[model samples]
Every structure is written in C-alpha cells, then in structure tokens.
Target: MKKDGQDMRQEGALKAADLEDAVRRADPDRALCARFLPASVRPDVEVLLAFHTELTRALAPARSAAIAGPMAGLIRLQWWRDVLEGARTPDHELAPPLLLALERGVLCRETLLRILAAREAELDPQPEVSAWRKMMLDGAGGLQRAVGEALGVRDAGVLARLEACGAAYGAGAMLRHWPRLQQSGRYLFPGDEAGLRGEGNAFLSACDTASLPSSARLAALPAILAERDLKRGSTQAGLPRGLGDRLAVMHAGWKATRVFQRSGAAAS
Candidate 1:
C-alpha cells in the first residue's frame, strides 16, 4: 500500500479500537459486551459501538453516583459535551475517545450533536412520551445513513431501517416502563430499575403483542424477541439477526430487576 493509504488504514484501526473499547465500557453487562467477537466486525463499525457506549453512559451517572440527591445525569452529559467540543477539557483519559472516533469518517458532525440534544431532552424536568421518542430517534437515526456511506454503500437506505429499529426499541422502552410512568408522573430514561417496572404491565403486554413485527416479543420473548431484552443468550439462541446488542442489554437489565425483587432486593 502507498504511505498515505497505510496511514489512513492505521488511523481507521485506532479509531475502531477506541470505539470498541468505549462501547464495551458502556454496555454495563459483561456477558453482552462479549458478544461482539474479535472477528465479526469491520473497523468502521466501531462508530455504532462507541455510540452505544457513550449514550448509555450519558444516561447513567446519577443512578451510579450512589447518593440520593438531585439529578446529576444531565450535568455529566454537559460536562462531556463541553470537553468533546473543546468547551472544557476533562481530566480523565476517556476524554478523547469520541473525538478520536470522529476522525474515521464514521459519522457526520451532527451525530454527537444529536446525542447531546437527546441528552438534553432526557434532562427535562418532565417530558411527554411522544417528545422523548422524537429525541431518542434523532440521536440514532442518522447513524445508519452515515455508516452506510462509510461502509461503501452508494445509496443504502438508512432511514427506513433505522426507523424500524428506533420504533421497536422505543416501544420496548415504553412498554417496559409504562407502569413506572403512571406512578411517578415523570418520564424516565434507561438505568432506572424500580421506576421501570412500577409502570403498568398491561401496556408492556400491549406493546409486546402489538402488530409490529419488530417488537412482537414485547410480551412473550421465545428467544427471538428475548434477544433485545436479555443479554445472556448467544446468537445461536435464536434472536433475530438485526437487533443491536445494547437493546438486548436493556431488556436483560429490566428483567434482572424483576428477578432481584423476587429475591427481595427491592423489598429488603
């Protein structure tokens, strides 16, 4: 290869490695993170993995903060965005992972912007479900389009596929959290365990059995649909071919909370 080509390849590889590492950090489930094997992904696909990690982490700080206090999650999101856009420089080494991932032609500039916008949406004191849905979709919807281009697709249709994923994933979130919303009078994001299950189980049932093929497992998983909500299974376990492992982790975390309650964590 020419020197220029070699340099480009090296840069791509570094970004890919950084993204994969970042995503693994974000997943919060060791078993699920391991599913992305060493050989299954191309270097360019790290964009999504990194995205998965960052977005998940952005929503989780307050809960993980281990102190009962005001919501600090959005503060953390702004803190990182400030660092990434050079508004502030973080002291931690994880500071530049997303910025480094940006150089690989993995996404347009708006990807991170949209993610921050979504975080802001999440930070609202109160949010309507419809509005929150739009915010969530915006963050991830463009990624497939961006990745299609980077992966050499001349005209790969991204909107339709990502819309499908967003709808399914979003429905799963609402269905999973319907009961919680009814009780708390607040719209919740991921990483809130008790809050999610307190919502109506009926809505989840409706969402699960809804006519959409993408989310048919909202109630009865049977392995295919269980893939999105649970992280323990392998590809051989028969989930559909296209779902992101992060969705699977989300599903698993919800279910684990149920199990923990049954075992008396919440009650205790």
Candidate 2:
C-alpha cells in the first residue's frame, strides 16, 4: 500500500532525528558546537555535519588496508556527488535531509563540492606537510563557511574569520586523532609526534578568536573546544565532556566579552 503524506512526513522526521543522534555519537564536539546555533537553523547544520561524518566513514576503509581497497571508497564518494547533482535519488538515511537542504538553498552545491574535493585530496599517497595543511584548511574551512552561510552570515570579514577558526579546529582534531591515524598507516602530519603538535599549536595561535565578531562567535565555537583539547592525548577518549566542555566554551565567551568591552571603550 502507498504511504499517505502524513506517514511520509513522520518518516522523514524520524530519519532526521536518527541522523542527529548518529552525528552526536560520531562527533560529539561538533554536536556541542551546533547547540549554539539558533534553533531554527540548528537542524540543518546538524544534518550538514552528519553528511560530513558520513564522508569520513566512507573513507575509513581506504585508510585501513585490512578492511578493503579504495574501490568502495571511490564509489561512495561518487554516490554523494551524484546525489548532490540531482542525477540520482538519495538512498541513505542522511542523504534525504541533506538533499532537502540543497533543494531549499540552505546549502550551496559549489561549497559542498569544494568540501568533497578536500576529502578526496586525503587519498594522495604520503602527502607532504604543505599538502596536508592545505587539505585541513580547505576541508574544514569550506564546511565552516557553508554553516555560516546557512546561518545567514554574508559579511566577507565574518566568513574569513570563520574559515581561519575552522582551519585551526581541524588542525587540533587531526593532532588529537594522530595515534589512530598513524596506526592506520595514515599520518595527519608528514612528520613525527612532536612535529604534529608544533604544527597544530602554531595554527591555533595564528587564529585570533578574539577578533571574531559577536555575531560569528557561535559559528566559531569549535575552535575554542579544539584549543582546549589540543595538548591532551587521545587516550582520554572523545574530547572533554559534560562540565569540562561547557566550561571551555564559557571561558571563550568571557574572553570575547572582554574584547567587546575594550573595543567599545576605545570607540568611545
């Protein structure tokens, strides 16, 4: 029997909720960051993040030779491209809402393509430090900019800050996941542990979060969380949780407040 319109709507809602839960479990830090977005836009942002998580999972087999060859990964990547281009219907759980976002103009096709290109770059064999850094910047920055756009952030200056913070956040994440990445025969950095830490720290320091306008702070909150987790080892398991993560965001917010006050005084 054909499902009624109400049944179809209910199914779609359930699928979206399931995707949100999957994203939260797969990437708790990003899920935490999504909480700061306006309620109206939060679901779309989470769906976008969920799409990212799906991309990462598709590459998992390629990252580990024992699992399978690159064929599966390539097919998965192409599937996403086809879905985004409207050449194919979305078959996966996350793809429906993602396609809806695209149809609604909440997400840009070009930006999503840019993001996919960044991930594809990771398949390069033994990428040099410069190449690795480029991948991080392009992949992470592109996604951040996409989220900002969805949030109605159109100012060039704010978008630039979002990209910078996103790059730094990506660097920290790579550093944190280095151990597993190394074990899988993939290196986040082309060098040793010390070199990875040094590179990631430099990236973080170069990003002036205090320069972020109040309007863009929520969009850039992950950078603050990344900074807090940078020095710590991965053995602790999945970024600071509960009160710890909350406190880090609060501290960053306080710093932003101070900057705003100083700027006001100077203007006066």
Work out the TM-score per prediction: 0.48, 0.80
Candidate 2: TM-score?
A: 0.80
Predicted structure 1, TM vs. truth: 0.48
Q: Please give, for residues 137-173, the per-residue lDDT of candidate 1 as tens digits.
A: 5543333333333333343233334333433444344
* Reference-based lDDT, residue 84, model 1: 61
Candidate 1 lDDT for residue 44: 39
Best by lDDT: 2
When summed lDDT is taken over every stretch of 10 residues in candidate 1, the lowest stretch is 1-10
Model 2 steric clash pairs: none
CA shift of 91, model 1, Å: 4.9
Question: What would the per-residue lDDT of candidate 2 be over residues 117-186, giving only the tens digit for each residue?
Answer: 7777766545588887777666787788787778667888777667767777887776676666666755
Badly placed stretches (over 4 Å) of model 2 are: 1-14, 66-68, 233-242, 250-268
lDDT of 2: 0.70
